[model samples]
Each structure stands twice: as C-alpha cells, then as structure tokens.
Target: MDTQTQIIEQIAPYQPWLTLCGVLVLFLLLRATRRALRRRVDEIGYWLLGERGRLIWFWINAPGVMLHELSHAAVVLLFTPFGFRITSITLFRVQSTTARDRYGRVVRSGGRQSLQLGEVQYVRPQGKLISYVGDGLSGIAPLFGGTAMFAFLYWIATGYNLWDIPLDAHQNWQLLRPDWPWWTLIFAPYLILTVTSELWPSRQDWTGARWFMVGLCTCLLLALGLLWYTNHLARVLSLSTFMASRIDFALVVLVVLDLLFLIIAELTARGVRH
Candidate 1:
C-alpha cells in the first residue's frame, strides 16, 4: 500500500472508539453542569418566556429569545442597516421598521399545554434580495452558536489532530497511538452536551432544513448506539471481563440527570412565555 493508504488503515480502527468515548464524556459533563445550574436554569426559562412574568420583565428576559432578536440586528448591521431600522430587540422577538411589506411568522410549542409564537412583518426594500438574510440569520443563531462553541472546545482539547503515525516509504508498521490531548478527556462531556443541544430538533417551517437536521441527529444517535453495542460485545466475547458491567449503571445515572434538567428548562420556558 502507498503511504497515505497505510496511514488510513492504521487510524481507522481507533476512530470509532475515540468518537464514542468523546460523546459519552461530553454527555456526562453537560448533565452535571445542568444540575449545578438548576436555579440558573429556572432563570433561563423565565428569560425565554417559557414561564409567565409579571409585566416588563416578561418582555425583557425571556430565555433563548434575545439571541433570536440580536441575530436579526446583527444581520441588518452587517448587510442592510441603511433601510432597516431596528425598532426593538428583545429576548423573544425582533422588530424592524424598514421592511414593512414582507411577512413571516413562527410558532413553537413546549408540550401540549403551552405555546410560544413570533411574527415578522417587513416591507421589501428597493432591493428585495437582501430582505431574507436577516430572518434566516436570526432563526438559526442558537444552533450556530452552540455548534461553534463545541467545535472550539474540541479543537483546543485535541490540538485539532485525531491521531499521529509516522512511516517510511517501505510500508512498514510505524507507531500507532491516538494523539488526543489530555484536556479533551477532562471536558469531553461538556462538548457533547453543547453540540447535542444545539443540534436538537425544533419546529421549523422550512421543511428542507428541518429534515436535514433530523437526519444529522439520527446519524449521531446511531453512532452513539453503535459505540455502546461494541463495548457490550467486547465484554460478552471475553470470558471474565467486567468492562461493560458498569455501562448500565453509568447510563441510568446520566439519563435520570439529563431528563431532570430537560424538564426543568421546559417548565421554566413555558412559565415565562405564558
């Protein structure tokens, strides 16, 4: 085999294991952080309007809402600030005075009991081409931010290299070891949580984008499942190994903690929105 081909073969077996370990670690860190911030999670829901607020605060601090508005403002500032007048940028909504002719609305539900909705009405400017940019940017800000954060952390931890293998032209077997940084092992769980939450499915009117994201999530879940299966299989194949014995115990603890934070965030967001 050529040098490149030989290198690829050497690295392939360990890739699956590395990816799975990273995911498991990331999930744990995120769950732990969520639990630590239980009170803050309540505040985030209030900020998102997931729960009802008395008066002004309801409009001001709604969870995940402000990011949406700032996204709009940012797009306008970058692309078309000339005609776009940002009237109000709040947590849940963004208003622009310039584009009065165009109309768009998005409604989101938090279970059957509560709903959160937003409408964007804009008049097309003299140049109609730039009108949609602001809307699109605002819609996907959370996903973008979350993914970027995770990637940044991963790069820092891994030195952006998955593995290292040096070889001479003779095609002889060279050093074989994963070159992951130590910090990656420490913060793997946080990275997984951030990426997963950012990539979670949400209601979007655009079917193409929605389905694309759904597919991505399915692939990720499958990868995680395969990792778990491999670990179990390894244990079963061994006569007296305890490698997979703790898998169930670890999973149950993680799932319970994950579900608790999810419920709290949903409830808080609902209360502020109402």
Candidate 2:
C-alpha cells in the first residue's frame, strides 16, 4: 500500500544478500575514498604549504596539528588502567639538513617532513601487554578528538551543541553567526576543516590497529547475518521513529558531510592539477 511498506517488502527477501553485497562494495569503495582523501590532503598541503622547508606553512596549521597529536596521547591517559606514559609530542620540525644512508644516498632533505606537523610518542611499561581494542582506540583518538572539537565550536558559536544543528542547511545559517565575537565565524570553520581533514589516522597508526579492526568487522558481519536471517534487519534499520531522532540524524549527517567534503576536496585538487 504505502511507498515505505512496498519498498520494505521488496527488500525483505534479499536482505542477507544485500547486506553482503553492501559490505563488499563499501569495503572496495572505502579504500579508494581513503586514498583519494589522503592524496588531496597531500596536494593541498603542498599547494598551501609550498615546496621546501617552509616554516610559515607549518605555523599556519600548527594549532590543529598540536590538538591532533595531543588527542592520541589523551586516549592513553583516559584508559586509566593502560597507564601509558606519553614521552614526546612534536608540533613541527625545523629545516632538516640533507642526510645520507649507509651508501650515502640523499634522503628527504626538505618539504613536509621538515615541517614535522605533529607527533605523539608514547610508551607503556615493559612486558605490559595492551589489548587489541585498547591499542586500536588509542591510535584512533584523533578522530574522536576532532569530532569533539567541532562540537565545542558549534556550541560556542551558536550556544547549542552540534546535534542541535538543523538538518536543513538554510535553517542552520544562524549557527555560523556569533552574537559577540564575530571573528569566530571565520576561524571556527577553518579550524574544524583542518582538524577534520587530519582525523584519519596515519598508516603507522593503523598498523597497530589493523587486526583489531578486522576482528570487529568480522563480528559485525556475523551479527548482521544473524539479523538478516531472522528478517529483523530491515525493520531495525528502517524504524520510522528512529529516522526522526535527532541524535541518529546528527550521526548520519556528520558522516555524510565528511564523505561529501572529502570527495569534493579530491575533485577540486584534481581539477587544480589539470
């Protein structure tokens, strides 16, 4: 009868297959997306930061970079029992002079490496084994930290939380305007964009968390399979009431916005190159 009900009935039979196919497609697409996003970040960094040991470029993004590094350290501190000590946090690097390896080959003498950006070095007690989940979360803390930063800025600018941001873009314009401090309108978006762009953990960060993510993904697939077999998947995912929920809407909006921005950035960078 109803359009929603008709759609649900049509999809009910293929729920499990759809789930599997969706997962497979997403897996492939996500890898491509990440690569494109990273490439764009590199391009933008090069264009804005410039080639060479440019100290000014690093200084421009220093605040975001510092917060990004600190976030990694914060996770260890938050875990309580983990009791890891943060050894060092490098914000940016000075000009690195040319160096040689054993064969006296030239290395990355200058550029992004020279800027250093930021790093959080940490260490745990000897022989103290950290669980995979803990290791993974600690490495991914910058993602959480960046989200928190966005939320905080949203509150400061609009006197409300990010979740309060209306789904309608036209209605959300007021959130950009501050009643007192006008400069926040300019700075907030720029800071958020910088921090958000860096939210993706580096390859080294994933090295520690790779298996953990794999395990989680496996478990999730199992659960999804079970739900599909029981024919509850569609109902659970399509709950009409949940569709209108603010928090649910906020999470979806945030994810969509992130992906959309990344795709746009990638296209823009490619266009500039051409």
Candidate 3:
C-alpha cells in the first residue's frame, strides 16, 4: 500500500469511537450552555420583578419542573415491584435554605434566597441488587423524558418531526426554511423555553446514584474491552456513529434555542435599564 493508504487503513478502525466521543463532548458543552442561559434568564427576571422575580421564574418553568419530577417518580414507580417506594412528590416549593458548595461551605446563608422547583422522594429496597441500576435510571430519567418532550413540542410547533429530519447538516438547514404557523409564533417559544430550561438533572439527583453510575461504567468498559479483543469493536462503534448522527440536529436546535433566549434576555435587560 502507498503511505497515504497505509495511514488510512491504520486509523479507520477507531473512527466510530472518535465520533461517539465527539458527540458526547458536544452534548456536555450544550448542557452547560443551557444552564448558563437559565441563570441569565433568572437574572433578568430579578431585575424586572425584584423579590417576586423568583416566583415568576418558577411559574415560567413550572411545566418543565413538573415533568422533571414526574419523570423521576415514574421511574421509581416502574421499579415498585422491585421494592422501590415513593414517599412524596413535590412539584413546586420555594424553600429558603443555606446554599453550600460541594465541600459543604455555605454560599448563601440568609433570607428567601433559594427555590426548590420540584422533587421526588423515594425509598429503595435495602437488599435488592437491582436497586443500584434502578437508582441510576431514576436519576437519569429526566434527560430521556425531556428529550422526548422537546421533540414532541418541536413537532407540534413547527409541524416537522425532528427525528425525521435528514442527518446532513446542510439539508437540515434547508428543511428549516418553511414559515411556521402564526399560532406557533405566539405560544411555541414559551413552551420550548419552559421545557429546555429544566431538562437537566440537579446535583442532588446525581449524588444519590453515584454507586450505580460507577458500576454501570465498569460493566460498559468490560463489554467494550471484550468486543475489542474479538475484533468486533469497529462494527459496534459504527452503531455509535449512527446514533451520534441522529442527535446532531437535536444539539443544534438546543444551541439555537439557548442563543435565542440569551439574546432576548440581554436586550430586555438593556431596554429596561435605559
């Protein structure tokens, strides 16, 4: 083989793994962007409504918060036969508590300064082996649930199915050109905004499932290692690449939504102050 062909042959086998890693990195970055946009929106709300701003923010994202907590509850209930029990489901509560860092240092210590949007309290069976995986699934339920919600709302508002869109970036842009309905223009933004804002799991959500995550990661690594040993890794990785391509459009939509809200907040802040 020529030098160029030799290089291609050497690097081709790992291409799927590279693509999957790239998609995961992009997913993490977009999630951070979503969180920052949420904080910016809250800041604008405070500037516009003062002490009542927190309440306004809560109500604005109420639908999403409900869904987030409900997703957790649903997963917990799904494991009910496995000895999981729901203690309580709080859809909305404004609780003023001292905010602490990961190390337990107090960050905020006085007044009504925190909002507890929603929570699902559940008890896991003490001796059940399956509870480990169940806990992790319950913790991560909001993400899967939120993605479904986002796709559905997008379809309703745009009359276009996000999953049905071609994976080609250029083709996707071309497909987005059609004018949306008048009613969509009025209500769709609010609906999309509410859902995306609360799509991620909170720190507390992850904390309770650390063991489950560690165990799950260990199992995945072993499986991947076995596949690599048998020389079947490339085929499996190809599937990863395909799945990554499917989410590319969804990530792009999220970035666009984040930018849109950030722009609106900045403009409103400027307009209000002047």
Candidate with best lDDT? 3
lDDT of 2 by residue, 1-274 (tens): 9999999999888665555455445545555654565556667667665753234434545666777787887887766576677677775544444444546677665553432466677666544446566667777777788778867865665466665654345554453444557666556655655565566676657766676788879999998899999998877665533433443434443445447768777777777667
TM-score of 2: 0.58
Q: Give the TM-score ranking, best first.
A: 3, 2, 1
Writing each residue's lDDT as its tens digit, candidate 3 over 1-274 gives 7999999898888766666776777788788877777676677777888857747667878888988999999999999988999999998666655667768787764554665777788898776779887898999888888889988888877667876663355544433326656576467767877887788888877876778889889999999999999999979877878878668767777777778877887787778767
Structural similarity to truth (TM-score) of each candidate: 0.34, 0.58, 0.80
- Which segments of model 1 are wrong by more than 4 Å? 1-73, 91-111, 115-127, 141-143, 161-188, 199-274
Ranking by lDDT: 3, 2, 1
Model 3 lDDT at residue 103: 82
Cα misplacement distance, residue 39 of candidate 3 (Å) = 4.4
- What's the CA error at residue 3 for candidate 1, in Å? 22
Cα lDDT tens digits, model 1, 1-274, are: 7999999899877654644565567567755665554445546644754554222222332333433334435555555464555554443542322211124543333333323323323333554434454444544555665444444554555444222223337766432224644655465544444343333223442331444345557997786688677776554334212223233233343454456556766676667657
For each candidate, the alpha-carbon lDDT, in order, equals 0.46, 0.63, 0.78
Q: Output the worst ten-in-a-row residue range by lDDT, candidate 2.
A: 240-249
